[model samples]
Target chain A: MIPTLQVFLIVSAALFSAGLLAALSRRHAIFILIGIEMMLAAANLNFIAFWRFNPQSQPPTGVMIAIFSIAIAAAEAAVGLALVIAEF
Target chain B: MSSAAFVLIAILTLAAALAAATLQKLMHATLSFAVALVGVAAFFFLLGAEFVGLVLVFVYIGAVAVLIVFTILLTRRDVGKDRGANWSGALLAVAVFGGLGWAVFKTQSVAIAAPHIRALTVKRIGEALMTSYVWPLQCVGLLLTAALIGALVLVMEEKR
Candidate 1:
């Protein structure tokens, strides 16, 4: 059986919490960046879940948003790591 | 069956995320993060977002994870030994989680209609991206180019 929307939302929340723990608790800059990535992933999951469960015959907006999010995330990582290296 | 698959994926994702957060070695943490990313890709697949799922794997696991590992290697000397979790950080995380949990519970009372499932083909997505989303797509491309140039400049050495 397919999981309910609540199930997806709860899982997203858990992942977001885990990401928060990682981002806040970690000392290393790279690990902190990883935490940020996790947070983004959680948000993406929420978007996809909503898209999948929405009653309207919506366009593929959620997938498009996910794609844009991934691209932006890649850019963020590239710049973030570069800054970390420069500081080091 | 799908629910079971979701549960498995959720467990795997959460475990990897926790490992990535709490691990002592940076390398191990990076690997764990990669696993977590893969689990997320699987989630996209479960939601029938095939293109997005593949993109997540290709961009996140293939590119970003590798970049992070490379950065760790280059800055090895700066990555001090794992100092364990800080109480202040833990407290902050807990507080954020608590707030989020409360929000989740609060929203549970509202009822939503049953979703209508339909196939979302790649062709439709492509058309939409080329038309309705074209401007935002161009902006994202510009952002990527700027980020690339910025990274190059940041890493460039000053010649004497």
Candidate 2:
């Protein structure tokens, strides 16, 4: 229970860094897409973690942003992969 | 240290994300991403956002993950052997990430002003979506619709 936010933040940073590396280093387009997903997940983690930690003062803006971001991410991935498929 | 469950989830999330990014096999990487997303969903639950967590499962695990794997299957030839990574990129990533980690660490002491969140139920979420967040919600729906149409168009090409 305690330090849950800390753990989540650390994990989110790790995910973001790994995703950035993968996106930069991968040759295949699909792997890059995977990297993008990891980054988005990291962002999502940050949103939820912050929302959890500051439950008494902040509105659920982080949660809403996270959900909206997830929606956008799903759509972006669908379109991006479809284009990649067509291009390849 | 807190309960074992929290530590377990943290480990699972990190391990899954690491595997997802580092695995050489494309299929394995995609699967690992799924695992990582699931772990994140669990984290959301622990954060008291049950609706968001389940939505993550549905959208990520069910839709997005499946879409990526299917795309991989469609373009099977492009997934060549892993080319490994460049040392420069790796070093740059480390330096950039180390700086970011330090920044967050330094800011950890600042107190954040947060409001109390009420229970987020389907009805409450729907009400908020339709009332205050209505425009954004509609925009998202429009975007998703367009993307779906575009996907169909992209995949429905004449056979060569």
Candidate 3:
């Protein structure tokens, strides 16, 4: 048996907290961006975990949502960093 | 629920987070973040979301991380070592985050249990995207296009 979904949630929480710490503690703007990415990734992990333990009738829908989210995140990061670059 | 894979993921997650937090060099921090992303992708795979896992790696590790590094390189004249964490800030973060974690765990204890995962195939996802989520899909496409246009304008403004 795999570790329960609860364990995954805990791990995600830990990741999020670490990212938060980085965001707060780091002075550099770039490190803050990395922290933001970490938080997003942590959320993505939760989505996948829930999808796995809680099987939907449709099955692939959950994973597809995550995939689409990843794509959107990529686009957002691109535009965000581009703006950061242009700004600084 | 105590599989070896879960243990591996837990270890990877914790280790990567530690690296990202403790590393002084900006480039090293970015690399640690990549490691964490890889660990996250692996977690997705274990959750039976192979498509999601692959996309996580490709979009996040391949595209987004690289773009961020490029931005750092281009924007900053020097990517130096970050001064390590401030003690007061770290303490405050830990306190707030610890409370949040406790709340999440406590709520989960009362919520409905999750069902076993069954369908995680690519075919099912494609069908759902085409059918139930058509509008959202279109919206995302439009958003991406707009973002790209905005990025171009911002960069051009810098050149001027």
Candidate 4:
């Protein structure tokens, strides 16, 4: 059977915790950045899950946000890594 | 059939996420993080959001992952194994997961199967972006440009 919305949410939660684990436990700055990125990706997944399951009366809001989110994420990664490079 | 796919992809993603979180080596952790991202893209495709899936693969794996790897290489002065993972952090993560899981189970509304939906096409997304979302799209472009310049300015070597 296709997984329900609950299943997707649970998975996203698991991913978020894993991100927290990385961010909290690791000493490296890069690890912290990775953790943050993972957390963002999980949020995107949650948004997509909600978008997919619900009946759409509006435009593709979820996908649009997700795309914009991805762009922002890339920008964040670039800036973050540059900061890391400048720091260490 | 889709459930099986979901299970497989979920396992892969979760396992990769665990690897990314707990791995001792920095490079290995980064690579596993990339793998986890690929699994997320797979999930997007499975959900019939092919355009989002493609964008995820391109932006994350293609761009972000490469940037991370490059950063690692540049900062390799002491790329030794990271300090060991903390048990307290793991415990806290588990606690948070338990809380979220309980909330998920208690909410009876989210347990329903996915409603039948039409495939999301790139054309619809383009039209929406061009029409209703145009302002936000323009803002994103500006945001990206600012981020690009900011990163360059931050990284440029200072003159003696």
> Which candidate number maximizes lDDT?
4
Off by over 4 Å in 1: B78-80, B109-114, B158-160
Using lDDT as the yardstick, the better of models 3 and 4 is 4
True contacts kept of 4: 0.86
Which residue pairs collide in model 3, if any? A2-B1
True contacts preserved, each candidate? 0.74, 0.61, 0.69, 0.86
- Candidate 4, residues B1-160, lDDT tens digits: the string is 2889999999999999999999998889989999999999998998778899899999988998888888888888876479878899989999999999999999999998888777688888899999999999999999999999988888885312
Better of 1 and 3 by TM-score: 1
Q: Evaluate every candidate with DockQ and list the scores.
A: 0.69, 0.57, 0.61, 0.80
RMSD of each: 1.8, 2.6, 2.3, 1.3
Better of 2 and 4 by lDDT: 4
Full candidate order by TM-score, most accurate first: 4, 1, 3, 2
Error of 4 at B136 (Å): 1.2
Which runs of model 3 end up more than 4 angstroms from their true locations?
A: A55-61, B108-114
**Model 1, position B82: C-alpha lDDT score:** 75
- Candidates in order have lDDT scores of 0.85, 0.79, 0.78, 0.90
In model 3, what lDDT does residue A18 have?
83
Q: How does residue B21 of candidate 3 score in lDDT?
A: 71
